[model samples]
Target: MMSILKADLLKVKRKWFWLLVFLGPFGVIALQLVNYGVRYDYLMQQEPDVWAGLLDNINMFVAPALLLGMTILASQIAAIEHQQSSWKQLLSLPVQRGYVFLSKLAVAAIMIFISSTLLFIGTVFFGIGLHFGLDIPFLAVIKNSYYPFFAGIPILCLQVWLSVVMQNQAFPLAAGVFGAVFSMTAAFAAPDWIPWKWPLLVGEHDPIWYAVAGMITGSVILIAGLMDFVRREVLT
Candidate 1:
């Protein structure tokens, strides 16, 4: 498994996928720059708690950015196999198909986690640049930026599954875009039922409940996808 995962990582070392990881979080923070660049004083006054206002602005784009990032990550990873016509070659190996799926999943998770971590750092840099103060909201920043990752497990699995089942990136990418759009509304209308809304739900009242639900639900979806892959005779 480790060998396979390592092989997968080496495949994309020079790809644009790495750029997308930085772009996801940096793009979100970029919006905040414009928001504050034009009206730094104005937005600061809106909320007495400086961190609240800054976080609010930062959170606005996190979900959308995350959605797009996940979409591209899944497509890019799947493309590694499709473009190289490596599926048959990989499956022909003595290893169980499950390892292949697991390798893909691990690679996807690591890529996103690194992106999310970069996002946290980017957020902090932007926050400090705006002079929000040295008394930072450490817990809030970490929670708000990263908790969504746990919630996005189902999304990660779904995107990966779609990518594997369908060779063309269109289906998976489209699903990701649609999910992001749906997330904006679902976060309020139906968080519990919708995985897309889980990331944005971090700022909500009693977010832990939703996060837990997302984990459990995401696990089910992930397992289902894995099993489906194991039984998959045709690699798209």
Candidate 2:
């Protein structure tokens, strides 16, 4: 199992994967900074409200980048097996297929979480540097920022399952793009009852109950995807 994980890490060491993992969050932060700058004059005129500010920042910056990054990470992990023709090689190893799938899922989820953390840190730093004031509740920002990463687990599993099943790079990437766009749209159009709503929309009104529910949904999807993958017969 450790060897499988190490092998997966080696696969992820490629330049493209690191580029997406790092640059994706950096780009999101940069865009958020820009948006903040554009709204600086307006925000300055009004008293800073922590919850409102945090929500605004999330809506503008964090969610979109997070979903996109997770999609890329998930797709690339599956792509490594297909692109390098190592799927069969890995499968033939003595480890359980479930273990192999879980390892990949773990790595993908960790990478996405790391990227999300970086983005959160960058946002905080940007807020401080710009003198956005300490009016923002540190706890609220931390909670909202971290919650989606957890909520993203099921989506990450879904993406990995889709990537593995399809074995085509483009489809997974497209799915990621579509999921990111759609989640944001759905959250805005009618937040209630949308599966994509909780993870993509972060704010004070974002109940802990909803996040808990999202976590459950994500976990179930991931487990189901893993089971499906384990039962799948690989021709290669």
Candidate 3:
């Protein structure tokens, strides 16, 4: 298990992965700047309450960025293994498939979590610099942020499984894009039955019910993915 984890870490340490990590935060910053620019005149006219503006920023921009980043990170985790034929080589070792799958999943989840947190921090500080000119209370931002991060775990796990089993990066990425789109659609269209609502929508004024539902649904999906990953055949 240690060796498997080490190998996974080594894969994540490669140049391409670091580049993605670096670029991910900058992408979030760019998006925030665009949003600020587009809405600045209106925002200043209204002079909306600071909390409201902060929440709006999170809902309109930060949540989607985190979800997209997690999707890309999760896809890359399994895609890299398949691309380098490391999956086949790892299977040749006398290790349990469950261990291998879990290790990879852990590495991916940890990396995504760290990256998302950093992106959130970066966006908040950027806003401070541009808007308020001072770092203010971020408790509301931090509190509201937990739902999406935790809610996304199941989606991340499922994406990892898809990337591992599908052998085609394009399909998984396309699916992720669809998921992001569907999340917004579901928020307004069905609202009740759309499981995608939990992980993709964030910064709601009242999100208790959605947060609880997200936790339950995310757990179910994660467990199902783990079972499938452990039992599925690895064909080199």
**Which ten residues in a row are the worst by lDDT in model 2?**
201-210
- Badly placed stretches (over 4 Å) of model 2 are 134-136, 202-205
Residues 2-76, model 3: lDDT tens digits: 888888888788647656665766786777678777887776567557545755565555445555666787788
Give the clash count for model 1.
0
Quote the positional error of residue 182 for candidate 2 in Å: 1.2
Each model's total of backbone clashes: 0, 0, 0
Best by TM-score: 1
Q: lDDT score of model 1?
A: 0.82
> Which parts of model 1 are misplaced by more than 4 Å?
202-205
As for TM-score, the candidate ahead, 2 or 3, is 2
Please write out the lDDT profile of model 2 over residues 1-236, one tens digit for every residue.
77878878887776487777778668876776676668876765564564466456655555667778888778778877787788888788889998898888888877877776776677677777876576656666666677777766667777888887786678888878887887767655755555555676543365565567668888898789888988988824
**RMSD, every candidate, angstroms:** 1.6, 2.4, 2.7
Per-residue lDDT of 1-236 in model 1, one digit per residue for the tens?
99989988998888888888888888888888898999987887799998878887787678877877888888889888998888988999998898898888888889889988987888788888878788888888887788777778788888988887788888899889998887777756763656787888643556666567767987888899989999889684
Error of 3 at 232 (Å): 2.5
Candidate 3 achieves a global lDDT of 0.68
